[model samples]
Target: MHTDSAAEPRLAGGPATGLVAALDIGGTKIAGALVDDTGRIRVRVQRPTPAREDGETVMRTVEDVLAGLAASPLWPGAGAVGIGSAGPVDAFRGTVSPVNVPGWRGFPLVERVHRATGGRPVTLVGDGVAMTAAEHWLGAARGHDNALCLVVSTGVGGGLVLDGRVHPGPTGNAGHLGHISVDLDGEPCACGGRGCVERLASGPHIARRALENGWRPGPDGDTSAAAVAAAARAGDPVALDSFDRAARALAAGIAATATLVEVDIAVIGGGVAGAGEILFGPLRRHLATYATLSFVRGLTAVPARTGTDAGLLGAAAAARTPRA
Candidate 1:
């Protein structure tokens, strides 16, 4: 499925050497891949997310995965270990809240990854930022100079690429797009705010609103944006309405983002993004409605081409970042 011409991978800053272990730690799963210099993954593995574990336990699970990778062909040969972890991380400090993982409040991630990865040179990055790097280097955002990459699943997260480089701010927190406000009078957010875009546009919020509208099927009735998209595709009125609401909120966010950044495109990814046109069609319509500037009008949102392995590619890119 990968169409890019493959290039020979060399050691970090030298002749292409061994593989880089890419780890993506999420609330639902931990996926790892041994990535080559050409962005090719030779081995892939995933395990259930530790739903009940504390910070130490989560780190243990990560260590176990790395140990397994080290014992297999996927083992790091010469490259480093790279991690794409959930935020909000103090990237400069290599620490994070670990979001859905309860025990990891300000866990030292870089140190953990280094210890678990056999003391290899390790790089830690935001999951959203990693996704954007993967897309820009090899997926839908490939060849584009400026664009936004968004993940719409468990949480709404984003990253930016400007002038051919991932735009992690000086503090490595530039593209935290979900916290932007859409309705100051809206719902409460985990970040302790009201009416943030994530409060209204995230997958859970979509399901919550659907329930309040008496959309039916009870609590078990379609709890994700993907479900809404399916129902919309099948001509379900309530489902359509639910997605329309998401589109409206996301469109507003898009318009505001485009006005500020004026990117060529916005590449949408993750679980919710699978909704395709059901979410994207209305999303485009909504963006059009709010756009007033000529630059904003030209902005289009496209689906990301990279799949689950995006995190690894991104992590590799981060490891290769020249020190400042």
Candidate 2:
């Protein structure tokens, strides 16, 4: 368990409007925060998720995190509870069935959390959608009326902002760009699809491609994508090629999205984006080849301003917005 509190000066006059209790739930951890209207996290707590455990056990961990948040003096002012969970989640059904957490299959997360928080209204959204909300509200897409926000990490996940509003779609997985097939005949993906963007652009795949292409790690034996990035920087052809291929695939997916939806900007975040210019350079170059349409040619790809706290802040943004 980990706990931290923001300094009082940041909260100062406090939120003009009350705070929102936010929960960011993922396979690795469950985090809780009391967030102000300005997106400041006043109180934060986290616990490693018992992802392999039974459904009830996982729920217990979430409850413990809530208990930690409830211990804060600001808890009483957090009138609404918002959750951003790994999906596929059914916001309409108030249930979540995250692919990484098999223990939860259509778990009634919203209802349980509502009960845990003394019946405060609970709003649910997929993690990607939550990240989009955060970006649209305060990050890279803040001034853009139409944009796509993506997280390219272990898996590629994304959400859309259209007409200045975050769109979660009906099932809360709207702009899920990872499953989009960029190479129709390349390779099968875990989502039962062929040649999905995630298959090529994910961090694991980047490292895998580099290793398969003879890019050996240095003495430290770190075989992660970050290590591959280091090798690429050192002018290793194989490492560079691997990232180029991933960049091409991501470019194809992003171009297709812009062509279909008219998004003016694509804000990318997550672990892989840390590769910096190593990935962006090729992505921009490849994008020029695919996004040739006059409408989409102007589309720009930029780094996401929101960092690790995106999930928590986005959940709070969702809690503040009125549901349609």
Candidate 3:
């Protein structure tokens, strides 16, 4: 999270080998790090995302993050660069069109990063795919051969792993559970879909539903899903109702995914997932009602263990994978 040039990172001991330069680009922030073979970040840098700026301006911010990483002594040992970007990304074309960062529409991110890194090979994947890579590598989905990893934050995003490998599909956007329509006659979603999981289970939607149900923010004036979670923990009916509805939507989506792919586990993360039992308790119960198939009867839902570093670590993990 250090934006100033004066901040110095703790350098790793000895000559670092198998190092990768990792970048996690999102609408909220852009994080960069030099990750070692052990998944430990040696040098780190971060900057606020210039989401509303022109494409070139956002690219400049990305370059700034790279510049900071390059300043670290470990830069020379890095063999390649891995990028996990908020998507709609096309890995084959090396282009990105993130929803929140409208400035980057079909932006040639791979070529730009390649040029910035002095021709070091670059690998790109959607943020959801990146998270899946991370979870499969070292988090809750480590031992599972098939699993779904989801991030329920300001938005809902997800990725899938099959046969012990991340499944990013041809366009690096295979497991986009957020846009999956769960209600045929429900509300329209921003993604031009109706009753999409994101429209129902995302942080914004959860809060909006609570507010619409006459739930008021506390003295802090905070009306985020986290606040609603706190209210639910305190036995507030409206808040609890909002979470239950989101959980139901999430359960339906997860069940549908499991039915299609036969995944054994669902790993949940991000801001709203901080609700913990308030979210998972109802989610598990609802999942039992929807995932009635024999193959999906044993599917378990778990919390992500990678924490906030999942994005950066996942990027590095992608770099180490063949063809990412």
Predictions in order: lDDT: 0.75, 0.87, 0.88
Write the residue-wise lDDT of candidate 1 on 52-152 in tens digits: 78777787778777766777855737367667888776666667777688888888877777666656766667888889888887899888888888888
Identify the runs in model 3 with alpha carbons over 4 angstroms from their true place.
Answer: 1-17
Write one digit per residue (lDDT tens) for candidate 2, span 1-324: 001111110101112378999999999999999998888899999999999999999999999999999999889999888899999988877899998899999999988998899988788888888888888888999878889999998899999988777878767788999999999788999999999999999999999999988999999999999999999999999999999999999999999999998999999998899999999999999999999999999988889888998899888887776533
Off by over 4 Å in 1: 1-18, 73-76, 218-221
Instruction: Give the Å shift of residue 14 in candidate 1.
Output: 13
As a whole number from 0 to 100, the lDDT of residue 74 in candidate 3 is: 81
Q: Which residue pairs clash within candidate 3?
A: none
TM-score: which is higher, 1 or 3?
A: 3
| TM-scores, one per candidate | 0.90, 0.94, 0.94
Candidate achieving higher TM-score, 1 or 2? 2
Q: What's the CA error at residue 287 for candidate 1, in Å?
A: 1.2
Show the lowest summed lDDT stretch of 10 residues, model 2: 1-10
Error of 3 at 182 (Å): 0.9
Give candidate 2 misplaced runs (Cα > 4 Å). Answer: 1-16
lDDT at residue 260 of model 3 (Cα atoms): 98
lDDT of 1: 0.75
